[model samples]
Target chain A: MEQYFVNKVIENNRFVIEDSETFKHVAKVLRHKPGDVIYLVDPEQNLFTATIERITDDKIETSVNKLATPSTELPIDVTIACSLSKKDKIEWITQKSTELGAKKIIFFSSKYSIMTWKKNVIEKKLIRLQEIAKNAAQQSKRRIVPQVVYVNKLTDLVDHKAQSNLVAYEESAKQGEISLLAQTLNQNPNSILCAFGPEGGFAPDEINFLNKSDFLSVGLGPRIMRAETAPMYFLSVLSYKYELTVK
Target chain B: MEQYFVNKVIENNRFVIEDSETFKHVAKVLRHKPGDVIYLVDPEQNLFTATIERITDDKIETSVNKLATPSTELPIDVTIACSLSKKDKIEWITQKSTELGAKKIIFFSSKYSIMTWKKNVIEKKLIRLQEIAKNAAQQSKRRIVPQVVYVNKLTDLVDHKAQSNLVAYEESAKQGEISLLAQTLNQNPNSILCAFGPEGGFAPDEINFLNKSDFLSVGLGPRIMRAETAPMYFLSVLSYKYELTVK
Candidate 1:
């Protein structure tokens, strides 16, 4: 069953999907008719089974029944703070991060960043990335779609800090610093964030500033993944540590 | 500071890059003249530092010095076997899997596979994917370029079984089959391979055959990942378990 994120909270036993994007996807794209069943996640991160009762020109009315499933979100929030790259790479980071259980995705312009969203284009680009996150979240059956944010400067990442902050520094991995990431996850902070550098990686002063700002330098592994692949590695490890490795 | 895989072993303290691809990349693409240094991984999986001696008309000659750095490969060998997907998706899987330390990558035809290469095209497709694996492996500084394989049927997977074989089943995860994966990892299997289904997932009999063939149905996590994302998750978890999470 396809999952759609609805904007409004479901108060009654019924709901209507009025968003043109959702309506078009459910009605015209899939051509779902009355009696068809689709999953709906509300603003409150509640999953409901919506049985289509009527499909009008603009909206689909459905009878909703909240499912008893637990939230699929990770136990701890993980925000992947990455330096901006090309358009496709950042968009891919957003989509893959959402699917792998990122709570928030932030893109910042670092000293070595190849591209940064201009003041005029930031809003449009963010909106597009946000849409990609929503669709990926729905496809992955996530209750809440992750928010994607953009900042012009790398230092701005301080504002989005989680309970524990770390930067994925390649130098750390080169120095055989394999244990810090696991050690950090061992503490089990309420929420954690890991900042990934762009293809050129963080300049020395940038790493120094982040280190001073309390972002511990850590390594994902020894392999040098592309800028985009690094965050997916981080998110997947987070999932393995918190979600899958329950003994 | 790029890494290239040379087909021949480094004899004494000298090596020659005879491969046309590596020659062009070192000579024409990167334009590294004499005295520029590069890392080389030989056929024996040995790492060596090669100082450019001369860029000849055909091959680049370099004086090699073996580096004592430990291997970057995962302690336990892992292979990601996925049902054939679209061209872009499978290619992405190959590249990401290489970056995440997959020792082998296998693509097989399953019931719900969207497309399959005919015998004539199979060689060509595998070459493209293998090229992708090589580039990703070099970019990630892998000791070995993972071999990419193709099989016509799901049953062929039995021929490639490892110490612990797993099929990433959505039904398994939905049933809350969580502990088995970690448990299997705990056994310290010398080598492991996991098969991933296509977008539509494996057919009942396909799963049955794999199960009967001793392929355990393992759940990755709570959320549903797309066909390509699941293998990356699995490989990342393997790296976390074998490489990083040292007690």
Candidate 2:
């Protein structure tokens, strides 16, 4: 069934989708008619059941069926923090990470980052990335669209709180450290943040700062992965380790 | 240090890089000056220490110092037989899979695949994907480039012998089954072949075909992944399970 996230909870036995974009999608693109089933997730993370009854140019009216209890969110809130990559590549990461159950996508400008968008372009870029996250969320039937944020300095990361933190580093690969990621998996914290570097990678000084912040270091593998691919590799493997393997 | 693969074995104190791409990369792009160090890997999988002695637009000269043995080629040759996805997405998978050490990439047409290129377009697409594999191999410091091939039928797969065979299926997910990927890793065979579907995914009849061919079915995870992302997720987690976790 097609899924959409609505900010308001179900009232009575029906939910109204008045948002223009979602209304157009459910009513126009999907061409859902009366009696067709669809899912609506409200702000409280509660899933509402609805059957399309009436479609207007501005609103989609659906008769409520019942509430849903299943959730696609991971037990832990994962936030991927790294320098912004090229536009297309960042979008790729956003989509895949959303599907993998990320709660937030944070971008920073590292000392060695290859490309940095102008300050004025950041908002537009972020909006586009958020769209990617939204689509991926709907495709994966996720209840939430991970937020995308921008940070300009290391202090920004230091200010954020997560129960556990880790950075995937090539130097860590050289050192043969496997337990950093494994230990994080073992701890199973309320939230975890995994960070990656940009094209030129984090400078030695940057890694030192991360180290001071108590960010554990992890290694992906022997082979050197490109900047964009590393995060996907990390998240996918992490998901497999905790979600699939344990159950 | 930057790394380049060379053809000749380092004997006593000398090695030669004769491949055109390696030559151009070392001689032209890098403008490697004498006394500058570059890592070289030979066909025997022996990495070496080499220093540039001469530099020219069309050629470069280097002398070997010592043999270094840093390699991650799996004991088994793993081939991924999948349907072609969108151009950029498939290219991304090619690059990441090469880094994860897949030996061969094969594209087959599945009954429900969304995009199918014509015979004339196949060769060009394959070549482009091959280039991605090559660059990924170099970027990851891989000694060999994984070969990319295209086939028209599932019958062709049965003809290729491998110690183990498997297919990833969404049905397995629906059944609440664990991924066979971990089990496949445990086999640690000389080689394995894994297959994945395109965007629309494999038909039920196609799954029957794979079953008859002795391909065990597995689920990647509960959440659905895009066609290109599935193979990368499988290979990365496999590499982690075998290469990283074990040793």
Candidate 3:
């Protein structure tokens, strides 16, 4: 079944999708006619199997067939906060991480980060990343699209509290500190926020600040992963630990 | 410390670096002179710390100071055989998987694979992919560079046997089957071969053939990962299970 993310909230067994992009995708691209069954995901991540009752110039009228349960969402919410890097690599991370079940993604400027987003460019970048996340979520059959947020500094992440907080530091890997991530996750944290450094990695001051702010510095493994690869590895391990190993 | 993969096998506490790529990297790029210390990785995945004694137009002579131990190599050998996909995506997989500790990578034509390698293009493709693996290995400080192989059919995998053979299947994920990969890995297999499908995934006939040929189907997680993402997920999970969690 075709799936879409709609902006409207589901109420009284029906909802109106007035977004022009979705309207064009359903009406023009897919050519979905009245009575075609499509899965619509609401803002709250609730999935509904709806039948298209009618299509209009500005809206899609859908009647709810039933509420559908999707197991694609991860059991725990994971937010990956990474320092901004090259443009294409960040876009790739947004797309791939969404498919791997990250609940939210936050990009911020780090002390060693080479890329910086201007205030005017931030909105455009977020819009592009959000689109990538939405398309990847729909393709992966995820009920909710991970939101992409931009933070101006690493210290801003201190406000994004979670049950478990970790920073992937390469120095920890060098010291052979293993199982901290697994041990932390073993406590059954309902939400996780994992931070990764930029191309050159986190500066000493950034690490000191994160260390003081209660962010547990964890290692991915012995090998040094590229900045873009670390978050994907983290999310994959989360899946294996929570979804695969526990059962 | 500079690292270079030398073609010469170490013997009698010395070896000559003759490969032009390694020669250019050490002699021209880094401008290393006599008495400089360089780490050389041989074909056997052994690391040798050597002092550069002389540099000539043809070769650089180095005397081994001592054998160094690099634990970047995984405990167990893993080979990822993926159905050939888009050119850049396959190249990306080769590089990333190598960094994540894959010992070998095999590319094959699948039933639903859109891209096919002609006989004439195979050698060039292999060379390109081999270069990618080599660079990634050096960047990740891996002891060994993964070998790239090409196969024509799924049945050809029988000759590349391992103690454990598994296929990443999306259907198994949809059915919520878990722990098979971790269980198989727990048996302490010295070598493992994991196969992933192309964008369209494996056809029913291909899955049936794999099922009959001792390849256990394993699911990564609930969400549908892209073809490129599945192999990385497999490698990350392997690292987490074998390297991190057990310790």
Candidate 4:
């Protein structure tokens, strides 16, 4: 069953899906007939079982009934701030991070970043990435789509810091800095954010700036993960620590 | 620093890079001079720093010296038995699984597998996937490359079972089964293997068969992950439990 995020909430047992894009998807693409059921998520983050009553010229008239589905959002909010990479890598990071329960996916330009978004193309790229995040969230059956963001400089990350901020440092893992990530999670911060560098890695001054901004340098593990792989690692660990494990 | 896996044990202080592929990579592609250094892993999984002594016609002579770099292999052996998916998904799974410390990557045909390996193309596909594993292993600086395997039937997974066998079942998670993944990890099993279903998921008969074969169905979380994303989640959680967390 496909789920769509509606722009408005259902006030009564009757609802109409009027968005042209969604109408085309539900009516034309899937070729769904009357009596077929789909999921609808409202702006208030509530899920409803929408059974198609009739297909009109522009609206999908549905009988809206709320269902007691378990929330798919993570208890501890997680933000993954990644340095800008190539087109495919960033798109992959966005899609996978959304599935792994990130609340916000932040991409920033770092010293060693491979491709930085130009001033004019930033809006179009963000719209495309936001579309990817929405599709992935829907595919994963998440309650809310994770917000995608971009920061122009490493210094901009300070404004979006969480209670527990971290920078994945490979050198620290090489030196056997293993316990900090676990210890930080043990503290049970309500929200946390982690930053990952590009293929060439962050410059020394960039790391220093983040460190001074209260972002602790943490090591994921012994093996070195690629720039895109590390964010997925962080998000999965978050889900395991908060959702899977018994607290 | 680049790393190459040699086919034989480096017995003495001097070694020659004889493999034609590695020779092409080091001598022709990278164009290394007499003083350039690279890391080499022998069949015994020993790490050695090889400094170039001379670059001959078909081989590169190097002085081998042992290095005290700590092992990057995970504490617990892991095997991921994923249902065969599209070419891109399986290739992505192989590369990421190697980076995350999977000892064996198994692909089996399930009732709902999207693509089944033909009798002819199996060998060629496995070779290409194995090459991906080797490259990812070298990139992530692992001591050993993960071996890729394929099975004609789901029952073949029994021959490759580990001490702890699990199948990621979505129904189990929907029933609110939590704490099993954590408790299983806490048991300190020496080896574990988990199977994942395809896009449409496993058929009921396949699940029943696996259940009868001592494969416990485990829920990842509340969210529904794609077939490819679930294995990465499993591998990342293993890395966190065995490598990052205090055990």
Q: DockQ winner among the candidates? A: 4
lDDT, model 2, position B120: 89
Sort by lDDT, top down from the best: 4, 1, 3, 2
Candidate 1 per-residue lDDT over residues B1-247, each given as its tens digit: 9999988878789888899999999999999999999999999999999999988899888999999998999999898899998898999999999999999999999999998879999999999999999999999999999999999988988889999999999999998887888899999999999999999999999999999999999998899999999999998888888878877
Mind giving the per-residue lDDT tens digits that candidate 2 earns over A116-206? Answer: 7788998998899888898898888788889998888756887665889888998888776656676667677888888899877788989
Separate clash counts for every candidate = 0, 0, 0, 0
Q: List-wise, what DockQ does each model earn?
A: 0.83, 0.61, 0.82, 0.85
lDDT of 1 at B32: 96
Candidate 1 TM-score, true structure as reference: 0.99
Ranking by TM-score: 4, 1, 3, 2
lDDT for each candidate structure: 0.92, 0.80, 0.89, 0.93
Candidate 3 chain A has its poorest 10 consecutive residues by lDDT at: A63-72
**Alpha-carbon deviation at B246 in model 4, angstroms:** 2.6
Superposed on all Cα atoms, the candidates' RMSDs to the truth, in angstroms, are 1.0, 2.2, 2.0, 0.8
Q: Report the C-alpha lDDT of model 3 over B1-247, residue by residue, as the tens digit.
A: 7677877567668888889888888899899999999888877768888799999997999888546454788899999999999999999999899889999999999989999999999999999999999999998889888999999888898788788999999999878788898799889899999999998999998999988999999998888889999999999988988888874
Each model's TM-score for chain A is 0.98, 0.94, 0.93, 0.98
Comparison by lDDT, 1 against 2, better one: 1
My TM-score estimates for the predictions, one after another, are: 0.99, 0.93, 0.94, 0.99
Model 4 scores a TM of 0.99
Residue B236 of model 2: what lDDT? 76
Q: Residue-wise lDDT of candidate 4 within B1-247, one digit each (tens)? A: 9899999899999999999999999999999999999999988889999999999999999999998888999999999999999999999999999999999999999988878999999999999999999989988999999999999999999999999999999988889887889989999999999999999998999999999999999999888899999999999999999998866
For model 1, how does the per-residue alpha-carbon lDDT over A83-110 read when each residue is reduced to its tens digit? 9988888889999999999999999999
